[model samples]
Target: MKKPSKCQSPGDSSISAKENDAQSNRSRDSKVAPKSEGLATGLDETEWKSRLTTPEIVLKEIRTLEGVSYYHGMVARDLVESKLTRCGDYLIRATDNRIMEFEFILSFFNKKRIHSHLTIKCDVEAGKWALGLLSVNQFSSVVDLTNFYKTNPIGAGFFLKRAISKGKYMIAHDRIKYSPKDDLLGTGNFSDVFRGKIELENQMVNVALKTTKLLDDTMDPTKNVKANKIKKEMIQEAEVMSQLRHANVTSFFGIAVDRLPILLIIEFCNGGNLQGHLIKFGDRIGTNERFLYLHDASAGLNYIHAMSITHRDIAARNCLISVNGFVKLSDFGMGLKVRRNESAEKVAEDDDGKENKEPKLPVRWMSPELVDTPDAFSKMSDMWSLGILAYEIFTNATKPFFNLDDTDVMQTVKSGKHPPLPLSMGPDLIRLLKDVLVAAPTQRTTADKFYNELHVLCTQKGALSLNGLTINQIRGISRKRVEHVTYRKLSYAIRMVTREIGVMHHRRCWLMLFGGERSEVSSRTGSF
Candidate 1:
């Protein structure tokens, strides 16, 4: 599958390693109780070792002990007794030979020095719990409380507070529906994207479903393991996104995690990506529209930066245009959060910082410092990419360093050269590009500074009014107009201007006006 490029560009090794170390320390400090409770004395390990371990053992134990319910509804008394005994919670399971039911009640100390309780239930019919039930509390269904307790033993109280508010970020596989003929939208290396319809708020709406590539059984075991690892990373990325709510960033609906080929449902963009939009409607796109797109992108980048997140892949290709012309940043495959206190300069100097095995980065958009000093990556790197994106927007998405190969491009960038700018770009924008393309991390503009300048530019042009339909939405409308006003006007003009110019000359002119290779336009629209 064709996945949008994130260009690896792993964070500087020192920062990442330090983050890993810090996480490891937290994990060590927060000791969780083991998830597997010991058998009640008599049952040996062999007897408990069935094809299914957890549910079977839990079923047998609950059946033997009888239900742990009280005859009286003496809430205060139970709280006092539970506190005295340090038995703050009760988990119960029931079965009627054919169907299984689980109920878990957790009690915690509230701020008023009183006990509070939360109850979660799960039911499974036949053998397909994954498809048969959608639990009211998704976390309870998705996370094993026993395992959670064990993992966060020291931070049990803290974890509980956060978990209560967090939704379960999983979607059962059966709920996802897509067909190549009807729903396929695009593909990427890591996943395939499809336009899907799902029930939300008692109505069906179009959603973009992205599914990861699964390992083939016949593939080498090592490759399979790597693929699984990649899938896990994508899931983790989705989990982070699920918590974010922003206008500039793409909205993540949820994810399907219970089976192979995991799926992520995101808000659909009818206008496709920024790069495609620019290519399709470049000639008709006015300066106002282009600035509007830039403004939207800047706003999204600034928001993410404020949240301490770095969208490592900042490019026109990764930016999506909604039908209303609003731009939303998408593709979080290589996205990561850095601690607010972490200095970009310090991260640039960490040990094991020069490893060539880091993920592949789009060389043309990379900052010189990032290329020269491996593991020197920072948000400044993304800022540099934003500079390239600016260049892309002004030039109709023409490739950066179009004449150079990857190796040469890196060397040239390291030598402090940037792509040649079109002479027509205004001084303000050229200056902005210079600030973003500076070789020193400290010299580059911060997201806030860039955003401020964009606002200033808009203010100067009296284009400050952002009606909120994104540039992409405007482009979509313009595309529809092509067959009506735009096509007629262009066709009439072409016929008039080229009346004496040869047929071959007319075709060449048409190709130039449309912004694509002759062969491509010919194949799609047929020879003029």
Candidate 2:
């Protein structure tokens, strides 16, 4: 298993020849690749083999198939259907979807303006290959099978079509070591983060193996299309991650497209995530110590925000704890690279003004704008979640809105209120939270300001006091308090009651004026 630092065509005869030999050894005498994995004593062979990209697989199969001009591996079916016109116009494309038993997928544009995909499979027992089921004819090899189908109509009255192989997408894939089932770190809807190892430069390095299953049902056009899209995004994610460099930001090792499920290798944190650390030891931590953790995270946040990348998912759970007990932000599944001249604040301007209404989000740490429609995550959303992260630290990771249902969390956000931080926190810290937790994106404190202030406070409490607060600065304590911290949520309740009372008083005044005036006028008329 050679890991190249750069991209190469896996279809190269030499590369395929070597890989084919290795693959054959793994399978007992079967000419085709084995579909399942069997346990081995030392390292898992499947993990290493999964590093083999699509072009390698196709080249291995067609190594001896004569007259098959070009091998275009792992092409999207949509591109094939649109480009190939006329009935019987056909092309062969490999799929990253691992489920299909294949020589290749035969995509033909039918007369009905639609495409039909027929799986080409091999029967190891007969040592023959066939196209389409219900066909009685079987050929000695895939080349012969494809030749037979080219001229003869199966059941659909279809005739021979040109075998077209378009431009191939080839790239050098990196390497990843197998992560055992027991070493799995976490899971997500589209990807899983495994505690795994990879060889970097010359030495072994532990990494967060973020992977999505590429070996699924490719027969379904929708599923295959989606799998490919995810692959593209994974590649794009790697591109974005490469630009980020900061001690507080989790380091990206590289991405591997060589295997069935592609790999995005990230720096693994040994102390687990900040959320877990807070839950276990937050109560025991002092204010200054907690500020140090927030300070570390803000430094990372400040760096990425400057890079023009929006880490849509930012929270205590996403923030990993390093061996030194510092906070490093992780998890970029929802991250999007901001386009040039585009501001993250403007991206969140909703015409409908809808907030994320999802009853429950992971850890319930999402910004208000993101909660309604996941698509509307603004660039400034990182700050919103940072505020939540601060709360998690202050509260020692106590679950937010514990008394409120998840549904109420959305409602709470809609009403321009958030689950408050502890009033017992230092006044300067409360004021800082006030600056960040605001609903308006423009009003929220900038990451630069947040990080700078926190950095100062971490060294000495109330060190961020301004010129106006010289007395407090001299005392080394912030006399300036966030007066509303204790009564902010109460003000919301008070506002509602006062509004009701004002409406009642106005209604009574209007009724009295109308009734009293009419009675006085009637009495005067009767006396006259």
Best by lDDT: 2
Per-residue lDDT of candidate 1, residues 1-528 (tens digit): 222111111111100000000001111223333344322211123322321123443333333322223111111223222432222332221111101112223444443444444332323222111111112212223135433543443223432332222124554333455553456686443345778766544445667877543322222433433443444466567756755544467777676533333467787777788898788777676666677677778877765665456787678878986554457788775333211112322122112234321234556776787664545667888788888888888889988888776667878888868887775567777888799888777888998779778878876975544443235255343221101123223544765687687655555554456431111112233321
TM-score (C-alpha, index-matched) for candidate 2? 0.56
Q: In candidate 2, what are the lDDT values of residues 1-528, reduced to their tens digit?
A: 212111122211111111111111233322433443321111255543443333333333543432244334344455456657777777654443333222355677776766777666544445555554533666675567667777787557877577764432222222355544556786443345778665445555566766553323222533444445555566667766755545577766566443344556677777677777677764566665577667777877765665556786677768886543446788874334222121222122211224322112442566676655556666567788888888888897876666676567666765657677887568888888888888887789988778767666654674332234222222222333211122222323433444556744433332332221111112333210
Residue 453 of model 2, lDDT score: 75
| Candidate 1 Cα lDDT to native | 0.50
Single out the weakest 10-residue window by summed lDDT for candidate 1: 14-23
Root-mean-square deviation of candidate 2:
22.1
Task: Tell me how far the alpha carbon of residue 110 in candidate 1 is from the true structure, in angstroms, after superposition.
Answer: 24
The backbone clash count of each candidate, in order, is: 18, 9
